[model samples]
Structures are given as structure tokens and as C-alpha cells.
Target chain A: MTTPGLTQVLLAGILVVIAIAVARYWRLPVIKDMAFGSVRGFVQLVAVGYAVRFIFDIESPWLIMLALGIMMTVGAHAASGRVKSVKGSFGTCLAAILTGSLITLATMLVFKIISFDARYIIPLAGMIIGNSMNASALVIDRLASDLRANRLAIETALALGKSWREASQKFHRDAARTGMVAMLNFLKTVGIVALPGAMTGMILAGADPVEAVLLQVIVAYMLLSATTITSVVAVELTIRRFFTRHHQLRIDR
Target chain B: MAVTGSILELCNLTRRVGDGTPARAIVDNFSYSFGFGRLYSIIGPSGAGKSSLLRLLNRLDECTDGSVKFKGSDTREFAPCELRQRLGYLFQTPHLFDRTVRDNIVDAQPHLSESKISRLIQQVQLPSGIVDAPVDNLSVGERQRVALARLLATQPEVALLDEPTAALDPANTEAIERLISSVVTDHGVTVVMVSHSRQQVVRLGGEAILMVDGQLIEHGDAVGLVKNPGTPQGRRYMNGEPQ
Candidate 1:
């Protein structure tokens, strides 16, 4: 269920108007891209809402499971291409995104923190899936840029017959840290400085305020955990692709 | 004929592209070595693994599985950067970064000053005006010089150039030849060039390694191979006979 409160609508409208104004004033090249993105977001969200309603009516667990698997695969591929650092390494990425998000979703639903329904499952998955994609992309891109810039140091380590992990050890930690920072910031401001959409929706729908607070706490924790796991998995797999068993980068011609 | 050692041995080093699904070896089973202070050129037909072989020296392509030793050390053991530092590479087509021509030359060592830059730029015979100009604005030959200057800047012990004179005008080609001759004479850089021109290799005068179907078929003194290539590989390729 999409939230339809006055505050939410007003905030969104203001964001759009501000975005246009900023683009115009700064002569930004991405004004069209921004507008196009917003329009696509609206259409996709609307379509997903309708699609979830139909799935909820079917009440088939297998179908729900299939839906989740498809979401993870598509999300992983999109995220892979989105950043040069990760460079489309999908096998590990798909596993990470799916396992992390689904496990978190399952635990929350069984605990009654979030009700077990398609409406909740689909939306929670969307939120977790979107953020996981972003964090993984950041992690992969950071690793790539780091690798590209310091290839000399990496090769020096390799020439000494060091393994891929040993060669890129310095970069691995930094790239993971950068990706984790966003999740950390989200955790810090979960309640005090901001009211998240899921929590606000529950509160507006007249659930007991305490229950809503507890539910939102679970959501925040799940998002943080899922994003962290996905980011780490993305970085490690991406770095391994940078070399081969013979300790060489298979450069594309 | 002066055939060099199996310093770097390749039993069946092949590199096949197009997903190399089964990992086919296009630059197949190439066995050769870096003889001390000796120059060599890997000449072959189009689609041959000439460039791929050059890249293999630096492990730019991990598909090269066989051994490429250097000074009794297994090439596989040396780090890619270390291998590359000892061997300079000039791409078939010249390309510079999105900065000034001088910056492209200084890419290998960014801390170079105006005086050092001018000397190298002059050595490559680039006009002084080309330094400040945008790299993208230069002709292909000018870009080649910049790439050559950058290679020299790295102070590599071996220079591997893929079609170094392919895109040049006659004048530019002659200047590049002179630059290569001087670099070899003064810098003592072991040069391995991939050239189709018999005339150019004759001008440069060194050893020759001929490849076909990813295999090294003939390698000997350049003068000897060009005059009377004993192997079927040398005679057929030089005669331009239909395969």
C-alpha cells in the first residue's frame, strides 16, 4: 500500500520542483535524465502495486518465491552494469542479494514485526532490493577505481607471487568501508532525524504507535544487514575477476 | 642464423577470443624468449596473434598458460607490473589521454618538468607546438610519437610495438624508424616490433620471429630470414603465397 498522506505528497512535489529549478539555474546536463527517472519511477511503482495485488489474491507460496528470485536476478544484473568496479560479475552478486534480503524478510515476517502478506513482502523486498543494489554498485565501483589507479602496486605484489587477495588487500577494506558508510548513516538516523516511509505508513493507518515503532526498527536493521552483506560479497567477487590462476589480468582487446 | 634459447618456453600457448567458451588459444603454442640485448620482431598475417603475443609478455591476457621466463625466472612468477616495467608496449593505434600532448608523454611519470619533457619530445621529433596542443587534435603519426615518448619515459628494458608504423605517412614512418634506431642504439631497449613491411624491418635490422596460426614457425637473423627464409613458414609468408 503506497502512503497517500498530505505530508508525503507535499514533500515529493517540492522535491520535483526544486530539482527542476536547480537544473535550470545550474544549466545541468542531467535535467532530462532526472525528469525521465522520476517518471519511470512513478510508472514502475504503480505497476508493481497492481502486480502485487494480483499475486496476493493467488495465495500461492511457490509463485511468491518465484517473484522474489526474479527480482534478485534482475537487481543483481542491473547493479553489476551500473558500476565499472564490479564489472558485471553476477554469480556471487545474485546469491548475496537474494540470500540477504529474503532471510531478513523471512525473519521479520515470522516474528510478527511485519505481517506475512504479499503487500508487505513485496514492498519490503523492493526497499531492500533497491538499497542493496546501490550499496553493491558503490562497493564494486570503488574497488575498480582503486584497482585501476594502483595497478602498479597490485602488480608488484603479484610479481612477488602473491595471490589476488594479497595483491588487492589494501583496496578491499577501503571499498567495503565506503559501501558500508551509507548503510551506517541510515541506521544512525533511523528514527530521530527521520521518519521512514514504512513506519509512517503504519502509524498513519492507525496501528498502535509502539507496534509501528518496533516494526520500523526491524526494517531498519534488516536493510542495514542486507546492504552490508551484499556490499562485501560484491567487492570480493569483483576483485577475484581482476586476475586469473596464472596471476594475470585477462585484458580485453 | 643465431637462434635464441628456450629462455621462455611455450608448449601450446593459445589465446582464442569470442568468449573462448572452451578457452580456445588464438595465439596458440608460441615458444620464444628475450635474448640479452637482441632485437626481434613477431611478424604475421592479419588476425594473427602478433598483438596478443606482445600483451602476453605483460600478462595483459591471462590466456597465455605456457612459461615466459626472464633471466632464469619464470615469467608467471614475476608480477604483471614488474614484467611490464621491463617491457614497454606501444598499441597498434595510438591513443592519448584527455589532456595536453605533454601530459600523455608524462603519463608514465607525471612529475617530469618542462626541460625533461622538451628533450624527450625532441628525441621523438615532435614539434614543440604539439606539446601544449590537445592530444585528440594531433594526427595519428603525432599520436604515435607521443606514445613512443611515453614508452621511453618508462625506461623499459624491452620495447614491444604493435604495428608501430602502420598508420603513418611516409615522412612520419621514416622519423619513427630513426627514433627506434636511436632508442635501440643509445637506450639499449630490446625491441620486439610487429611489422608487415619487409623494408622497414630491414632498415631496423635485427632478429625476426614469424608466426602463423598462433605458432612461431621461423625465427633467425633478420637479414638471413628476409634473404632466404629456409622454413616453409618464411618462404610462403614472404612470397605472399596463398595459404
Candidate 2:
């Protein structure tokens, strides 16, 4: 199968026009978002595509690491925006995402399942970083809200001589689970509900169906590990903000 | 009524809330000494910082200035969890874990034996069968009793009762009052209860501290303080006069 050219991409513009027309007809408030989102997505993806192509051509490990670092920093910044109510959220997100993505990628490289080549690492890093970013954000947001909402329960536990970790144990589990729920659901209903992006992209690029399935399996496992690590790290960091060294619930933030 | 040596002492305890210029003091320069094997009731109108003072005693909220000494040592010296264990606090609204009554009690003392759990149930005057019952199945009164049992399971030297019966019916209230009295007499647990009801303090019959707007207005024998307050503000409060 041949890659789609600029002419074929121009044809996709008709779909965006149709969506904007429908929004206009319905007088929806999201008309501006829809129109702006189309342009922004186009620009962002095109820029990323060029950047990835340049990184892949370089074939230097340092350049690959630099690209991954940039991706993680941007992902952390985006994740932190979702949890603006918590202090030090950016640092928390950065640490969690970096730890999760790097650990999973390192494991894959060590096992020789994936090579150090940028062609494999760059795209794989993108997927792991993206999933870790979302997981980190969800964990932080849910934990903050749950801790604030259940101050009475938490304080009661602390008053009963429980450590801060023990006092917020329930909330920590809940927040971590909240972050992983999406990935778990995706695992449960991946092919039956919808073919995931990596598998579909592979199939569209004319890879053998069996090979695509195998690669998708690896992607799923990588995500599960990344998200689990990210969620746990996020909870560990975020829970500290709500509590003091004295086991007191300090939600001044 | 003469009491022995103090168990908990608060010296110039103050808690200021807010970050703006001139932060407001919720508990302003409060000082008190609570004796062991005795019950003390803190009576005050709404927003008198009675609850705030209790929180400070437990170190649930930090004091901006001053210190709380448990058994003559600064609270900071002991680990916070260890201090809280020794000084148990019960909230106005009971917060039981979403599990069986037995689990709630066992949460405080995880290694508690079955016989001990049953003993705690009986100590709180709760029905023995309620132990296996889910906390969600229990009424507000039952929940409060379970909470008290949980508080006692920690074997705290002092119990900070923050309106333990606030949500209970008159019958439940009477039962809880009896339990409070028994805990003091039987276990010799020091209790510092915060209550808005003047009559409850009189009925509890111990030392009483009256607070208004973050200041201790008056304190004496409960019945005496309620019947004939020394200060004009205390007298007006007893008379139900608006401030």
C-alpha cells in the first residue's frame, strides 16, 4: 500500500468542513473549538511528523534521548494543567511520567524486544509518555478531590494514631485505580470494541495481520506497566501535598 | 471538686487562619490544663473556637504560636501519631469505615482478639450482635457508639469528645452520656468534651470552660458555672442573651 500524498490529505478537509457545518446548523457553542481544533491538530501533527523524521534520520542515541526528554517535558506540562488545584503538580507529573516511560522503555530495550534505534524507540516513547501523562494527571486530580472531600474520614484515621500513609490509604488506592481504569478497560475490550491506534496504523501500513496483533500485544503490556507505575508515583507525590510531617491534613493549597 | 496533676497542658495556644494581612485567630492565646481521671466540658456559642481548641490539643491543626504539652513534654517531642494515639479525638459526626462494626474497631487495634472486640462492644453499651453488622446498617446512635468503641480501642490516656452525641436522639444521648461517665469511672480516661448544650455540661458535672470568640470567658464546676456564672458575659450566655 502506498502512503497517502498531499492530494489525499486535502480530501480529508471535506470531513472537517462537514463537521463545522453541522456545528453551525445546530448553533452549538463548540463551533469555534471544532474549527480551531482542526487547524491546531493539523499544525501540531505536521510539526511532530517533521521532528520525528529528523530524529529518525540522525540515528544518534543522544538525539533520541533529547527527543524523548522534550516529549516528556511537554507531556508533564499538559498533565499538570489538568490538576491546577494542587501545588508542585508539574514536578510530580514530570517525575511520574519520566519514571514510568523510561522504566518500561528500558525494560523493553534490556530484553532485546526493541532495539535502541530511534525508529522503534521514538514512537514507542511517544505512546508510553502519552499514556503515562494521562495516568499521572488522573491520579493527581482524583486524589486531590477525594482527600479534600473526605477530610473527616482521613482526619479521623490520623486521630486514631494512623500514619499519613495509612490515613489516606483508601484515597490513594482509589486515585491509582481511577488512573488505570481507562487502560484496563482498553485491555478488556481492545479488538472487540475497537481496533486500537497502533494496531490499526500497522494494518493500514500493510503489515501482516498476525504481526500487527503481536505488536499491539506489546503496546498493551507497555501501557499497562507505564500507567501502573505512573499512577502509583503520582499518588505517592500528590498525597504528600495534602498532609504534613505531623500527620495533619494541610490543604492550604 | 479538687483534681490531681494535669495530663495535658496548653500554653498560649493560638491558631490563625488565612494568608491575607492581619490573619484572624480562630483560637487566640488559649491556655488550659486538663487533669487525669477527670472530665472537662467546653461550652460556648457558635464559632467560639471550642472545636478549634480541641483540634489544637490533638495537633490535628497546627498552632501558629504557643505549644501543647502532653504529660509535661512538648507535643513536638513525641511522634504525631503516637501523641494522637495517646490523645484520641472523636468528631461531632462519626466517620466509620464502610465495613462491619467489628472492622471499624479492629482498624484502631488491628491485633485485637475476638474476646477484646466483644468487650469493647459491651463497654460502649452496643449490642453484641452489632459487631458483625455492617456500619451502613447501623443508626446514627449506633454509629456514634461504634465510633466511641473505636476510640477506646486505642487505649488513649485522654479522649477528646467533640459533641459525641450531637446527632443522637434523646434516648441515644442519655445512653452516650452514661457511656462517657462509665469510661471516665471505669477506664479512668480523661475526657475533654465540647458541647453547645449548657444543660449537658451541667449534667456531666465536672469542670467547665466557657469560650466566646476564641477567648476563655469562664471556667469552674459545671453546675456552678451554669447556674451562677461569674462574668457578665457568662451570665448573659447562661441567660440566652444575644451577644
Candidate 3:
């Protein structure tokens, strides 16, 4: 299979126009978002494609490390934007995303499943960082909202002599599961429901089907580990914001 | 009333909110000493910091200024978990865990035996066999009773009741009132209840404290204080006038 040229890309842009037209015809409020998002997505992806290709050509370890750092920081910022309930959450999100993605990437490298080459490392790390970002955001948002909504239940436990950790143990499990639910669903319904992105991209690039399947399997495991780690760390940090050192609920903060 | 030392004391306890030039005190400079084995009803109109004061006592909400002493030591000295066990709190609306009635009761004291739980059920006047029933099936009043039983299972030195009967019907209210009286009478636990109803305050027949704008306005015998308040704020509160 040959790579698509600018003409093929121009043809794909027509779908965005069709989506915006449909949204306008239905008087949906998201017409502006659709148009703006399509344009922004195009610009961002093109920029990133050029950047990744540049790094891949150079294959400098420092540039690769710098690229990973930029991706994790941007991912953490995006994740923090989604969790508005907690203040000063950017640091927590950054730490969680860093820990999660780094641990998973290190494990993959240590096992020699993937080389240090930017071609393999950058894309895989991007996947891991992106997924970890989402997991961190979901965990923080769910836990914060759950803690707020269940104030009576949590305070009742505290009033009954339970520690803050004890009072919120159930919510911690709930938020962690919520963070991991997406990966779990992917694992459960992979191939049958839909061919996942990495596997499909590999197949589209003319890789053997079995090899793509194997790589997809590794990606799934990588996401599961990253998401679990991110979720646990996010929960640890977020839950502390709702309770004081005295074990009192400080949801106002 | 017992002449023994106070089990719980509030020393200029205050809780303020907001980040303005002068933060508003939800509970301001409130001080009181609660004796062992007595019922004290804190009375006030809405927004008078009745509930806030109760929360401060249990350290569910931290104090902005001053301190709470549980048995003569500042509450900050003890681990909050251990402190709360000795000062069990019941919220205005009971929040029973979604579990069996017995399970809710045993939550405060996990090792509570079947016989002890039955005694608590009897003490709280809940029907027999209701213990095994899921709390979802119980009415709000019964749930309140279950919450009370759970508080009782801790065997607290002082039980903080924040309008525990506020949501109940008159019959349920009377049942809860009776159980509350028994908590002090039968178990010798000090009771500090926040009440909105003047009639209910009189009915409970203990020491009544009137608070206005987060300050202690007056305190006296429950029946007398409700009948003839000593302060202007107390009078306005008793007469249902906006303070």
C-alpha cells in the first residue's frame, strides 16, 4: 500500500464539511464547535506529524526525551482542564501522568519488547501518555464528584469514628474502576466490536495481521497498567484535597 | 443534673467562611460546658449556626478560631477517629448506610454481637426481625432510629443530635424523643441536641440554650426558657420573629 498524498487528505476534509452541514441543518448548537474543532484538529495533528518525523530522522536521545516531556506536560494540562472541582490539580495530574507513562515505558524497554528508537518509542509513549492523561482526569473527576455528592454518607462514617481513608474507601474503588473501565471494555470487546486504532493503523500500513494483533495486545496491556497506576495516584492526591490532616471533610477547598 | 466535671466543653469555638476582609463566622465565639448524663437542647432559628455548632463539636468542620475540648483536652490532641468514637454525632436527616439494619448498627462497633444488637434494637424501639431487613425497606423514621442505634452502639460519652427527629412525623418524632431520653436515662450518655421547635425543646425537658447570630444568647431550664426567654434575641426567636 502506498502512503496517501495531499490530494487524498483534501478529499478526507470533505467529511468535516458534511458533518458541519448536518449539524447546521439540524440546528444543533455544536456547529461552531464542529467547524472549529476540525480546523484545530487538522492544524495540531499536522504540526505533531512534522515534529515526530523530524525527531525520528534525527533520532537524538535528548530530543526524544524532550518530545516525551512536552507530550506528558500537554497531556497533564489537558487532563487538569477536565477536572474543575479541585484546585491546584495540575501538579497532581502531571505527577500521575509522568509516573504512569514512565513506568509503563520503562517496563516495555526493560523487557526489550520495544527498542529505544524514536520510531517505536515516541508513538508508543504518545499512546501511553494520552491514555494515562484520560485515566488521571476520569479518576480525579469521579472521585471529587463522588466525594462531594456523598457528603452525608462520608461524614456519617467520619462522625462514627472512621478515618477519612476508611470513610472514602468505597468511593476510591469506584473512581479507580471508572478510570480503568474504558481499557477493560477495550480488552473485552477488541476486534469483535471494533478493530482498535494501533492495530488498524498497522494493518492499514500493510503489516501482517497476526503481528499487528500481537502489538495491539501489548498496547492493551500497556494501557491497562498505565491507567491503573494513573488512577491510583490521582485518587491518592485528589482524596487528600477533600479531607484535612484532622480527618475533617474540606470539600469547600 | 450531675455535678461531675463537664464531659465536653466549647471554649470560644468559632468557624468562619469566605475570604473577604472580614470573614463571616457561621459559629462565633460560642462557649458552653456539657455535663455528663444530661440533655442540652441548642435552640435557634434557621441560619443561627445551630447545625454548624454541632459540626464543630465533632470536628466534622474545623474551627476557624478557639477550640473544642473533649474531656478537658483539646480535641486536636486526639486522633479524629478516636475522638469521634467518643463523641458520636447524628445529623439532622439520618444517613443510614445502604445495608441491613443490623449491619448499619454494627458499623460503629463491628464486633457487636447479635444479642447486643437486639438490645439496641429494643432500646431504640425498632421492631424485632427488622434488624435483618435491608435499610432501603425502612421508612425515614425507622432509618433515623437505625442511625440512632448505630450511634448508641459506639457507647459514646456524649451523643450529638443535630435535629435527629426533624424529618419524622409526630408519632415518629415522639418515638425518637423517647429513645433519646432513654439514651441519657438508660445509658448515661450526655446528649447535645440542636432543635428548631420550641415545643419539642420543652418536651425534651432539659437545659435549653438559645443562640442568635452564632452567639449564645441565653440558656436555662428548657420549659422556662421556651416559655419566658431572657434575651431580646431569644424572645424574637421564641416568637418566630425574624432576628
Candidate 4:
């Protein structure tokens, strides 16, 4: 397959035009979001493509680490932005994403499955950071909402001598599950339902099919590890905010 | 668990809520002392901080000013879990865990013996067979009884009830009122209940503290306070008129 150029990319713009037209004709509320999102996505991805190219060219260890730090920060900010009820969640998101991505990346490097090179570490870390960011956000959002919604039940438990952790134990499980559910479903339905983006991209880039499949398998496990860690960490941090040192539920907070 | 002096004391208790704008005190400078093995009903209209004061007692909501003393010591000195265990709270609409009634009671006091659990169930006037029944299947009145039994299982020195019978019918209300009275008279648990109904207050008949805008309006015998309030605010509140 030949590499797609600017002309090919311009042709893809037609799809966005069609989507926006349909949204306008239907009088949908998403028209503005659709238009802005499409434009924003193009600009962001283009910027990322250039940045990745530059990072790959440099191949400096310090540069690679710096790039990962920037990516995680941006990812954390975006993740925290999605959650409204939680206060001081940016720190939680940052800590979770950093822990998840670093641990997963370190495992891959230590096992020599992926070398500590920019070409490998940067792309894989990007995937881990992206997924972990989402998982952290989901965990915080779900846990905060669940805690608020079940205030009476939790307070009842607290009033009966249960600690904060004991009172919100069920919610911890639920929020962690919410964070991981998407990845879990993806793992269950990966090959049979649809080819995942990474695998598909590798295949489209003319990599051998079996090699791509193996890489995809590794990617799957990497994501599972990252998201599990991220979800658990997010829950640990988020649940603390809803309770006081005295184990009382701070419902208003 | 012998009867002594005041089991719970509120000293200038206050809770203020709000952001940038002026913080309004929800439970403002309220002071009272609840005696042992007695029933005390906190009577007030809506937003009078009846429930707020109950919350402050158990440290469910932090007091912005003043303190709550449990057994002659500031409540903060004890671990919150221990404090809550000793001072059991029942909400207006009881929230029973999604489990069998027995499990709900056990959840409160894990070490409660089978016979003790049975007695608690009986004390709350719930049918013996209802122990193994799922709380989801029970009526609201039955759930309230289960919650009461759960509170009793803790063997708390003080039972802080927040409108325990607001959701119950007249029959259920009377049944709960009786159970509450028995908790004090028989079990020796000091009951501080928040009741919207003036009639319920008279029926409980221990002491009634009338709160208006988070301040104590007047407090005296439940019968006297409900039947013949001393202050204008108390009189207006008893008559169901705006204060």
C-alpha cells in the first residue's frame, strides 16, 4: 500500500463536511461541538505527528523522559477536566497516570520486551498514558457520583461504627470496575469484533500479520496493567476526599 | 450502661455552610444536655436545623464552632468509628443494606449472638420470620424497624434518631414511637429524636427542645412545650404557622 499524502488527507475532510451538514440539517445540538471537535482533533494530531517525528529524530534519553512527562501532564489535565464534582483531582489524575504508565513501561523495559528507545518507549508510553488517564478520570467521576448518590447508605454504615473505607467498599469496587470496563470488554472482543487501532495500523503499515498480532497481544496486557493500577490508585485518592480524618462522610464536599 | 448524668452535651454547637457569600449557620450556637435513659425529641419546622444538630452530635457533620461532649469528654477525642458505635444514629428514611434483615443488624454489631439478634428484632417489634427476609422486600415501616434493630444491636449509650417515623403511617409511627420509648425505658439508651410532628413529640414525652433557625427557642417537658409553648416562635411553630 502507498503512503497517503496531503491530498489523501484533504479527501478525508469531505467526511467531516458531510457530518457537519447532516448535523445542521437535523438541527442537532452537537453541530458546534462536531465542527470544533473535528478541527481541534486535526490540529492536535498534526501537532502530535510533528512532535513525535522530532522526538524520534533526537533519540536522547533525557528528551524521551521529558516528552513522556509532558504527555502525562497534558493527559492528566484533560482527564481531570472531564470530572466536575471532584476538587483537587488534577493531582490525583497526574499521580495515577504517572504511576500506571511508569510501572507498565518499566515492566516492558525490564523484561526486554520493548527496548528503552524513543521509537518504542514513546509510542507505547503514549498508549499507556492515554488509557490510564481515561481510567483515572472514570474512576474519580464514578466514585464521586456514587458517594454523593449513596450518602445516606454510607452515613448509616459510618454511624454504625464502620470506617470510611468499610462504608464505601462497594462503591470502590463499582468505580474501579467502571474505569476498567471498557478495557475489559476490549480484551474480550478484540480480534473477533474488530481489529484494534494499533494492530490495524501495524497491518496497514505493511508489518507481518503474525508480528502485528504478537505486538497487539503485548499492547493488550500493557493496557490492562496500566488501567488496573490507574483505577485502583484513582479510587484510593478520590474516596479520601469524601470523608474526613474522623471517618465521617463529608457529603457537601 | 447505668443511668448517670447527661450522656450527651452540646456546647454552643454551630455548623456554617456556604462559599464566598455570607456563611449562614445551620446549627447556630445550640446548647443542650441530654440525660441518661431518657427520651428527648428535637422539634422544629423545616430548615430549623433539627437534623443538623443530630448530625453534629455524632460528628457526621463537623461543628464550625463549639463542641459535642459524649460521656463527659469531647467527642473528637475518640475515634469517629468508636464514637459512632456508642452513639447510634437512625435516619429519617432508614437506609437498610441490600441484605437480609439479620445481616443488616449483624453489620452494625458483627459479634452479636443469635439470641441477642433475635431479641433486638423482637425489641423493634418486627416479626421473627423477617430476620432472613431481604430488606428490599420489606415495607418502609419494616425497614425502619430493621434499622432500629440494627441501631440497638450496637448497644449504643445514645440513639440519635432523625425523624425516625416521618415516612411511617399512624400505626407504624406509634409502633416506632413505642420501640423508641422502650429503647430508653428498657434498653437504657438515651434517645434524642428529631420529629417534625408536634403530636409525636407529645407522645414520646421526655423533654422537647424547640429549635428555630438553628437556635434553641425553648426546651421543657414535651407535653408542656407542644401543648403550651412559652416563646412566640415556639407557639407559632407548634401551631404550624410561619415563624
Among these predicted structures, which one has the highest DockQ?
Answer: 2
| Decreasing lDDT order of the candidates | 2, 3, 4, 1
Q: Best by lDDT, which number?
A: 2
Give me the runs in candidate 2 sitting further than 4 Å from their true place.
B1-4
Model 3, docking class: high
DockQ versus reference, model 2 = 0.89
Please estimate how well model 3 matches the true structure, expressed as its whole-model Cα lDDT.
0.91
DockQ (CA atoms), all models: 0.09, 0.89, 0.88, 0.86
Q: What is residue B6's positional error in candidate 3, in angstroms? A: 1.3
Candidate 3's error at B149, in angstroms? 0.7
**Model 4 residue A174 CA deviation in Å:** 0.6
Q: RMSD to native for every prediction?
A: 9.9, 2.3, 2.1, 2.1
- Candidate 4 lDDT, B25-124, residue by residue in tens: 9999988899888999888889999898998898888899999888788888889899898998999888898889988988888888999988888888
Residue pair clashes in candidate 3: none
Per residue, candidate 4 scores C-alpha lDDT tens digits across A10-113 of 88889989998998899999988998898899899899899989989988999999999999999999999999669989999999999889999999999999
Give per-residue CA lDDT, model 2, range A1-253, as digits (tens).
5588877778888999999999899998998899889899989999989998998888999999899999999999999999998999999999999989989999999999999999999999999999999999999999999998998999999999999999999899999999899999999999999999999999999999889999999999999999999999999989988888888998762
Residue-level lDDT of model 1, residues B1-243, one tens digit each, is 223453334445666667656775678877666665567777777766787787776565665366666666666676666566566777777656668987766656667888888888898998877788998788888888988887777777778788899989999999998888888788777788899888777777888888887778888888788778988867888888744
Per-model i-RMS in Å?
7.2, 0.5, 0.6, 0.6
Q: Report the CA-based lDDT of candidate 1 relative to the real structure.
A: 0.75
TM-score of each: 0.61, 0.96, 0.96, 0.95
